[model samples]
Each structure stands twice: as structure tokens, then as C-alpha cells.
Target: MKNKKEMAKEIIALVGGESNIDSLIHCATRLRFTLKDQSVAQKSELGKLPGVLTVVETAGQFQVVVGNTVGEIYKEIMEQTSLGEGESSDKGSRRSKGSFLEKAIDVVSSIFSPIIGVLAGAGIIKGILLILTQLELLQKTTGTYQILNAASDSVFYFLPVVLAITAAKKFGANQMVSVIVGLSLLYPGLVTFMASGEPITFLSIPVLSGTYASTVIPSILAVWVLSHLERLLTRIIPDVLKLLLVPAISLSVIVPLTLLIFGPFGIYVGNGVSSLYNSMYELSPLIAGLFVGGGWTILVMFGLHKVLVPIGLNDIATLGSTTIFAFAAPANLAQSGAALAVAVKLKNKEMKSVATTASLAASLGITEPAIYGFNLKYKLPMIVAVISA
Candidate 1:
């Protein structure tokens, strides 16, 4: 068997080497690459590589599916390439290749991927707390419960700050500045003022006060603008003065812009999406459930499921619960069930072992291993799983 390092090197080479790669980011189970030239990539060769489950080309990304070890493989690739240190490198050619929708998906996925694991952990803690409280095992009033609840909710509460850092990385802006912008939005004084229903203004411009914490679009838009503004400043500002001026200017401009424009716009967008989804669910929950349940895995296959993650998160933030996960859980479990059946029925020993492991992983709510590794490999199982979901 090839070691992870060897596999990583081979995977990078097959995907047209470091120079061909414009950027690389990994999700839970795949190393997603934006290549300068996709045609040069040896996709078939990559799928045949040891430890590689499959190759999925979608949303302008060349995704190498390596199942659970994707993180290790991604680390190896980064260590072997310049990508980690080349965040500011020009990617115009790469950017120009994808359609607007593809670019949007790629950008959103990259921005959100780094934090998904932590989000899942926090969510699990919340879920466990809920279960404990419902069973009367833990009182909400207890210190233990309060501490655990804070631990779980902290990520969501400070989500804008967290997202600002990630979005800054995605947009190639100064991370600290982006974080400051996010922090400004959620600053205790500002939040308190907004809650108090007091009028505020920035330089005579009336700021539209709204909740920024736990929201998605505002921080992203702010960081995106910051990226462009930073570039312009770099070009115009004297090199010696830039050290002092760039960040100072960016903060002054972006903070107010975010407060006055981006923050409220994002709030509206988030609210609109949540409202639309809820309205759809209310109109015909059966159809909504059926569509989300049956097609969730399909969306995952194309890396489009991420588009719904924020909506689900927004639903939780605004409505205290979400239908997205409610429908998705059964879909995930159905994949596990289908994989379990595959494990039992497969005659080949190696195949059975793979199916068994995939089954276990899918059961734990990480379904990529099962979907790409076993279920999708067999059409009937995937079809049955979809229908079952």
C-alpha cells in the first residue's frame, strides 16, 4: 500500500502539479482544487490512485475524494506545494475559467469548509445538551448545563468573527482587518445600542442597525470589499506609508460600510432565504421533505449541498430550529442503511470491508465515504437509498 505522502504526491501530480493548481482547499472528505487548466488533469488516473475513492469535477473544482484521510492527504499536498503560502498569488486565469454560479459555489465552499468541523462539534454538544435536558438528566439551571450550553452556542454567537477570518482568507484580505470588521458588527456596545433601539450614524450617514452575530452574508461581503480595497490601496499608497495607512484606511471605510450597507443587506438576504424556505415547507411539507430527503445526497455529490448549509444555520439562528437537518438526517441514515446492506451482500472480501467501513461512517453522519466509496459505485443501492430517504 502507498503511504499517505506518496499518495498525496501522486494525486497532486495527476491533477497537473502545483503550478497548474490555482488554489486548494479541503472539505471533510475531498481535496478540492481550482486548477488553472482543468484539461491537463489526469482525472481517470487520479480515480485509480490508491486511497483515492473517486474524482468529481464540478463547480470549477477538481475534487479528489479520499474519504476520512482527506485531511492528512490535504496536509501532505500543502507541505509539498506552495499553495499554503501563496494566498496572495494572482489567480485571474483561474478565476476567469468558471461561470458565475460555479465561482459562487467554489467561493462559498472554501469560505465555509475550514469551520464545518468545529460547527459540527458545537452542534453535537448542543444536541446532547438538548437530549439531556429533555430526559431530565441535566437541569438547564445547573452550572454544568450552563457551561456546556455556552460552549456549544459560542461558535454560533461569534459566527461573524469566525466567518470573517475564513472569508478574509478566501478573499485574500488582511485577516485581522476582516476580523475587526466582524467584531465591530458584534461589539458589545454596538449590539447593546442596536438592541436599545437607539438611532446611530456614521459620518452623518444613518446606520441601519441589525443583528450581525450568527449571520453569514454581511461578513463575507465586507471582506470581499476589503479585498478589493486593499488591492487598490496597495497600488496607490506609498510603500513606506502603506504599513500604517492601508489597515487604518480599510477599517475606517469598511466598518461603517458594513454597518450602514452590508450588515443590513445580509440580514435581509438571510431573513429572505429563511422565510422562503419556511414558506415552501409550510406550503407542502411532504413535498419539501421528500425533495430535501431524496436529493440531499445528490447535492452532496456535486458539492452544491453547501449552498443550503448557511440557510440551515440561518434557520437555527432565526427560528430556533431547522427543517433542513431534520430532513437531511433521515437521508444520511438511509445511506448508512444501504451501505450496511451492501456490506452484508458483497461476496468479495475487500469490497465487503470497504462497504462495512463506509456503512459505519455513514451511520455517524459523514456519508461521503459511503456515497462515493460504496453506494454510488452500485447504482441500485444509491437509487434505493434515495427513495428510502
Candidate 2:
């Protein structure tokens, strides 16, 4: 019955208060804790907290599983403990004392954690469409297929909006400013420049050019920079004019700066990654596919897949399309096959239930549960699939 905030306070108290903690981090479902003393930390006590699902002491860290809302719980804990007190007066100061990695991870987690459900749900729906289309049952030209594709693809097509909101939250900038920056990418002039194919000139500045649809690095980086600039603008300006003038000042500064710096920088980074991927492809398509598809699965299992998702998106945007999608497709298929294999082979009720769920999740292109839950538990088969693929 207790709220996440209430439970966060209790966990902070149990972990010898906020001061005893050297650092804290979190994954999709767990609060990874590094404390001054593992013995005094009392993982058992923290595990008993209402919101906590489980406790994992692994690799010299005490991980408290808070399910999907770990970020919200973390925010409450930080607020109650004044964890970011020294970093920023309003918020984000709690782990100001924590290491750079802690802060970076926290920022990343905060941005993606809230939107993960939507991402997974959309991805699942898209996966179903892919399966249906590939099976020759649902023609892409059909009205039903078109409508379903549109419904599923909306998140990806307008991904900048989602990133804008989350990035604003993470950067402590005004949501509207972040949104404005995202909008700039879709501006008429920008599109006109792309249409003309005559070298993008940002205010006649000859800006670097690349499509931004489904882009990750550019928008995220732009928003991050804008968030900081917005903070500075918000810090200044008269109190009487804070509301209206702040946004105006931020957009004036950020939009121009975004075109000049972040936009080009993102384009370059995205292009660089794409080039690197292609250079490897020149070595061998089979190698590239294996690396992308099979290697990617391994990375996703450990939550390292996010690093590549941006790169893959960047490739698709800068270049026309990608084989990375092909790579990703196989991992899903392999997980699905492995899960189905388990469902057929296993008779235990609990095991059957787990396998059934895993099979469905994997079939829908969500292999993490299979990778981390069932596949990783039964190590040999996971190894075999990854190797054969």
C-alpha cells in the first residue's frame, strides 16, 4: 500500500542513511548499491521494504529490485535524503558526491526508465507485424497491414518527441525548450534543404546534412546541451519576466547553438559510427551480419544493447538503411526458437509457464527475459544459439 517514495525513504534509512552510501545506480528493475560497508548495509532489511521485489548481492554490489519504477523510487529517496543537495539547489544534487559514472548512469536511467514500457510495447507490436508480413499471411499493401504498421511505427517516426520529454526531464530544462529543439529538426527550411540536396546551409553557414528521422544521438545531444543553456538562462532574467522571457531567451540561444554545434556534432558522430560499421562490412558481409545480429544478442542480454541501438539508428538515418536490422531479427528468432524448444522439452509446470512466457516475449522481439531469465539460466543452449547464428 505504501508509495514508492515512502518505501525509498525506508530503504535509505535501512542502508545506514544517505551518507553511508558511497554510490547508487540502477538497471531496468534493480537499484545497484555500493556502500561503505556491505555487512552494515543489511541487504535483507532493505529487501523487506514494501516496494522492493528482491535483493541481489552480485559482483560486490547489493542490487535492490524495484521493478520498473526504480527511477521514481530513486527520485523520492534522493529528495527525502537531500542526496543531490550539493549538486543543484532544487534537485539532482543527491549524488553530486557520487562519481561521474554514477551521475551519467543516473541521467541515462532517468531518461529511458519512464518511457521503457512504451518502447517495449511498441516494439512488441512492430515485431508481430514483421512476423505476420514475413509469413506471407499479411500483405504490406493490405489496408489492415498499413494501418497496423502506422500504429506501431508512430513511436519510431516521431521518436524525437519522446526523447525531448525524457531528455528535458534528465537535463532539468524546460520541456517546451527541449520540444522546440526537436521541432527545429522538422522545420520547413531544414526539410527544404534536404529536398534541394544542395548542401545544407544553416543561415548560409553550410551545415552538415543527414536525415533525422528515427535519429538518437543528434536529438539527445542537442537537448542535453539545450537543457544546460536553458538552466543558465533560467538562472538569470528578472523574476517578473521569468515565465515568458526565459523560454524566449532559451530558444533564441539554444536553436541557433543547436544548428551550429550539437546538430553537426551529432551528425558527425552518427556518420562516423555508420562508416565504421560499413568498413567492417567491406571486410565481409557474413562477418558483419554475424557481428551485428549474433553479437548484438549477447550485448542485449547484459543491457549493453542500448549502446548499439543509437548507433544502429544513426546508421539507418545517415545511410539509407541497415543490415543491423537483419542482425537484430535473428537474435529474436533464436530466442524464440530456444524458448519453443524448452516448451516442448520441459514438463515441469513452473518451467512450462516460464518457457511459454519467454517464447512469446522472444517471438515479439523482446529477448531480454529469455536472455536474462531462461536462456542465461540454462547457459549451454544460449551459447549454442549465439554460436550457430
Candidate 3:
């Protein structure tokens, strides 16, 4: 509320001032930095900063989770600090692999970093729709309901596009090309082609047993393959024509392959996963809950969650119900409980301040900082919450 400038300077001073940092950037809710020396970072003071949540040193970066206000604070930090120009990425490694403590922090940061922002958007819209529907402001018969539903749903409806864009970058592929590949599977002709009345078979194999829209793994897998193809093309193509030739060839080869092999298989795999999940739920709702509810935070914290998201969406698309979504609800509920527990347990005044903020975030089902910085490190309370659920 005080704006980014005032609070950032206070944090800059706390974390050994601007002098201790080498570079900085931010995501939706975290100020990620590289510090001159971990020893100099005044974690205690940083925790006391007005807007600061907590200082996290993990994932080869110094992280300050600022909830929704991070981007503004990041700009302020960039403006006030004399961090050097764009330089080489300083990839850091922790003390030892044998340490379970280090591995736990690594897992938490790894899982939560990328997925949190998009999840917040989706959750907010969903929450808003829930509010409107309860208030009777969005009637089922009205356009308001349809429009708001579209807003609430597209994140899950056309999720493959979002996954494609992010996963391509994750896999070191050209994002635009990867997005093109993802969208192509949704093309009207392609949908019609796959669902055609004619019996289409390739080498005695059915062309497509399922649709690819809103899927997760296939587009990502295709991009991974395309990235290698791009790298290989990079080696052979003349430097003069590399830019043009690379895209042309990559698209030409990748698109066909994606359609022929990747799209169909990705759809099949996604469908198969849903089928497996359906069987699980039919046997025992509690077992289904145990997998998704107990493991949701763990999965969301790690990049692996992206793999299951498509199946959840696929179930909604095809079957009109999703057990994974139902399961995810309990995990979030447990996260809120664990966050409240941590807020009660931490004694350091600075840590207390961060815990208070994180408790609020978790109550709203935004647990990135709580998971990445505190609950994960402390380990016991978080694990208890998941296991209890």
C-alpha cells in the first residue's frame, strides 16, 4: 500500500544494503537475486522489512517472496541498487548432495517457482466466479454467467497453449514455434480430421483415439524434441542463413512429426492417465484423495506437476468431472493449516513477520513462500499436514 519504493529500500538496507547483491529480478510474487556473499545477507533484518515476507536462499538464488506486490518492489530494487549489467548467469551449487536438508529446500523451490503465478490467476478467477454465483449476480441463464465462466475456465480449457509456451522455454526450444505446434493440434481441420466419420488408420493403428486440446505433456515433449533438432540444425547451418533456416526447417520437420506422432500419442497418454485415475477413484475416493490431496503441494512445488495437470483437464473435457481437481482441494486446505501452524511456531521476530504474511497468502491458497521458504525447510509441520490429509 505504501508503494514499492519505500519498502524496497528498507529491504535493500536489511539484506546488507544494495552492496550485498550482484543482480536481481522477480516473478509475480518473489524478488529473486544473486547476493555478493550469503554471509553478509542479514536474514534477520530482512524479515522485519515492512513488505518483505521472508528471505530464501535456494535454487541457486536469493529469493524474497513478496506475494502480489513483488514486481513493483523488484523494479524499485533495480532502480535503487547499482547491480551490474546483464552478465553471465551465476549458477550456484549448495554444500553437499548427501544432506537431506539441502535436497528438501531444493525440491520445494524447484516445484513452486514456475507454477505459482499462473495458479494464482486461475484461482483468483475461480474464487471470483464462486463469489458471483453465490451472490446470484451471475445467473446461469444470463450472458454474465457465460462470459465469467469463459474467464474462469479458459486457463483449464486451453491450457496446452500456456504449458506449451512455458515448457518450451523450460526445454530450451523456440517458444513461438512450440506454441504454434500446440495450437495446431486445436485447429478445426485437425480436430475434424481426427474425429472424422471415415475409419482412418496409419499402419493398422488408429489415427487418434482422443483429442489434444488442453493437454500438457505432448506439447512439452514435442518442444523437447524440437530443441534438440534446433541445436543440431544450429551446428550444420551456415551462420548467414541460420536464423531463417533454423525456424523453417524446425517448423517443417517438427510440425509434421508432432502431428503424426507427438500429438496423437500425447492425447492417448493424457486420456490413458485419466482412465487410470477414473479407475482409482471408482475403487476408493480416499485413495484418489491420498495421491492428489496429499501429493498436490509436493507436485506443484516440483516441475513434475505439469505432467498431471493435463490429465486433470482432459478428464473435465471428456468426462465432465476430475478427481485430481477434487484431490487438489484438500492439499490446498492442508497448506493453509500448515502455514497457520508455522506462524505459531517461529520465534524470531523477523521470521514471525514473514510467517504472518505467508499465513495470509496460504489462507488464500497461495503457498509458494510458505512452501519454498519455511514449511519446507522446517519439514515436520508441512509433512504432518499432508499425511494427515
Candidate 4:
């Protein structure tokens, strides 16, 4: 395989040079680029490059598939370029790049991508804890179990804080200020007060503070609003006072606004979405299964699969298990099977090798390689996989 830096340099050139890049971010397996001119990207050449699995353009990102080495490749690219993380230079081109929903999906994927591994680890630990307690092998109250449980639970419990930092970056807010806002929501004293079931007031006005931990929508909305408020304050506040005064004014206004408005609004919105999904599930689970099974990989193709992650996480946190991942599991397996079949049928040695690798990756729970690299590009196999799913 080529050196990561060599690969990065070639990839950058193939995507119409560093100048063509509007913004760049990476998920577990792909480097997503918002390019100034999508037509300039040499997608076929990029796919053929050493160490690259495939190239996909969807959800407003010119994505280069690099498998496990994506992080290193991303790091190398950043080291070689003036475009720092969370900083975009192609504002003029971005406005015309994609639809609002596509842009929204891009933002969501970028925000959640960095934290997925740890979140998955926490979820796995939570599952193990449940099994141990259920099997009576370990008591939940024991200090050993308690500590391990905290390890499993802490990620979700303080999810708002995690989301805050990432969301702030995506929304172009001050990350430190966003962290402060997140911490304020999860302040120990506030949590205690909410636990005590006491009526809450902030500055003599009634405040509706509740659990902010393990929630997604509220923190994202709060940070978005905070970003605008911060910008406004930055403009009006004197430069001499900007650093100190801006944060003070922003946080003071934001914290109360969040408590009175965004926090409860998010809770209600989340509840409504969960309830609606549950209702759909109840109406006809088989139909729901078929719907997700047939459409899940397609959803993934457009990067819309990320929308399900928070919902699945919330479901696991709230109900102890999730139906979303379960529904998609068969789809993943189907893609694996289809890719393997294609590997056997293909004549070219290189294509066969790539297909085989993708099949293996998909079987092990990473399907992007198989889906984007081969299956989705070939209409028949994609249809077959969806039907099998």
C-alpha cells in the first residue's frame, strides 16, 4: 500500500486540489469533502488509487473511501493544508452545493461521527452489564458493578456535553462557551434540585429545568442559538471587552432561555418522535421491518443513516434496547452476501479482491465499503441485496 501521506496528496489532487475543497471531515471509514466544484472531482480515478476503496458523491460530500486508515489520512491532509478542523473556506460555493436536507445530513454526520466509537463501546458495556445482572452473576449494587456500570453509562449520561462540543464546532460556535452551557445544564446542584422535585426559578422567573443528560436535540439547538447570540454580541461588544463580556452576556441569556424554552421543547420533540416511531412499529412490525430492510442501505447511501443513530441511542437509553439497529442488521448482512456473490462471479482479479474485502468488512458490521464500493454502483446486486434484506 502507498504511504498515507502519498495517498492523501493524490486524493487531494484528484478532488480538484485543496483549493476546490469547501470543508473536509472524516467519519470512521471515509473522508467527506464539501467541494467547491463537484464536477472537478475525478471520482473514478480516486476509486482506482492505491489504498482507496471507492469514491462516492452523496449528501453534498465528495467522499473518498479509505477504510480504517481514514483517520490517519485525515490527519495527514490537515497537517498539509491551511484548512483546519471545523473551519471551512468555501462559503460562496457552499450556498449552491446541496439541498437543505442534504446539508443538514452532512452536519449531523460530521457532528456524530467523531464520537461513535466511544458511544458504541459504552453501549456494548451497558449490554454486558445487563447480561451480568440478568444472569445473577453480578449484583448491580456492588461497587465493582457500580464502577463498571458507570463506565458503560457515563457516555450517554453526559451526552449533552459531548454533543455540545461537536455541535458547536459544526455550528461555528465557541466550543469552550458551548461546554460551559452543557455543564450548566448538568450542574450537580441543578440535577439535585430537579431530583428533589422542587419548583425551579432563575432570576425570579419560573424555569423548567429537567434532565439534560442522554439527550440530543436540546444541546444542538441550544448551541446553534448560542452561536448566533455569540456572533451578535461579538459585533456589538467593544473589542477590549469582547472576550470577557461576550461570554458573560451570551451564557447568562442562553442558560435561562434554554431552561425556559429549548430544554422542554427538545424533550417534547424527542418524545413525540419516539412515540411516532413506536406507533409505526406497533401498527405492523413486519411492514416496518420491510421498510427499513429495503431502504436502510439506500438511506446510508445518502448519509441519512445517521439520523437513526441518535434515535437508536435514545431508544437504548430509554427502553433498554433498540429496534432500529436490529432492523438494519439484516440489510447489512444482505449486502455482505451480495458482495461475496459478486466477488465469486467477477472475472477481474482486482475487482474480485476488492469485493471480497468489502464483503468481509460488511459481515463484521462495517458496510460502507461494500455498499458504496461495489453493490450500489451495480443496480442488479443492489436490488438483490435489498430484496434479500
- Pairwise TM-score winner, candidates 3 and 4: 4
lDDT preference between candidates 1 and 2, better one: 1
Off by over 4 Å in 1: 88-96
lDDT of each: 0.88, 0.68, 0.68, 0.83
Best by lDDT: 1
Regions more than 4 Å wrong, model 3:
1-64, 73-116, 123-141, 199-206, 272-280, 290-311, 334-360, 368-388
How much does each candidate deviate from the true structure in C-alpha RMSD? 1.5, 5.5, 6.7, 3.0
Give each model's clash number. 0, 4, 3, 0
Model 4 Cα lDDT, one tens digit per residue, 163-246: 999888777788898888888889998889988978888778887757787888788889989888887887788999997998
| Candidate 1 lDDT over residue span 1-389, tens digit each | 59989998898889888889888889888898988899999999988887888889999889888888988988999999888885743431135357999888888898898888889889999999999999999999999999999999999989999999888877788888888998998899888998998889878889887877788889999998998999899899999999999999999999989988998898899999999989999999998898899899999898888888999988887778999989998888999999999999999999899899898888777889899888888889999999999
Q: What TM-score does prediction 4 earn?
A: 0.89
TM-score of every prediction relative to native: 0.96, 0.72, 0.66, 0.89
| Candidate 2: tens digits of C-alpha lDDT, residues 1-389 | 48877788788878877777755655555666656676777777775666565566544445676654677887777778655544222332223325665455445554564565666677668879989989998999999998988887777777776788777655656777788788887777876787787866556776666556666666788777766665676678778888898778778877777667776787777788888888999889988988877787766543445555666656655564677766777887887788777767787987788777767877666665566556666787688668755
Instruction: Give the lowest summed-lDDT range of ten residues in model 2.
Output: 87-96
| C-alpha-based local distance difference test score of model 2 | 0.68
lDDT (10s digit) by residue, model 3, range 24-69: 6555567766566767777877766656656666644567767667
Error of 4 at 352 (Å): 7.2
- Residue 83 local lDDT, model 4: 72
Error of 3 at 344 (Å): 11
lDDT of 3: 0.68
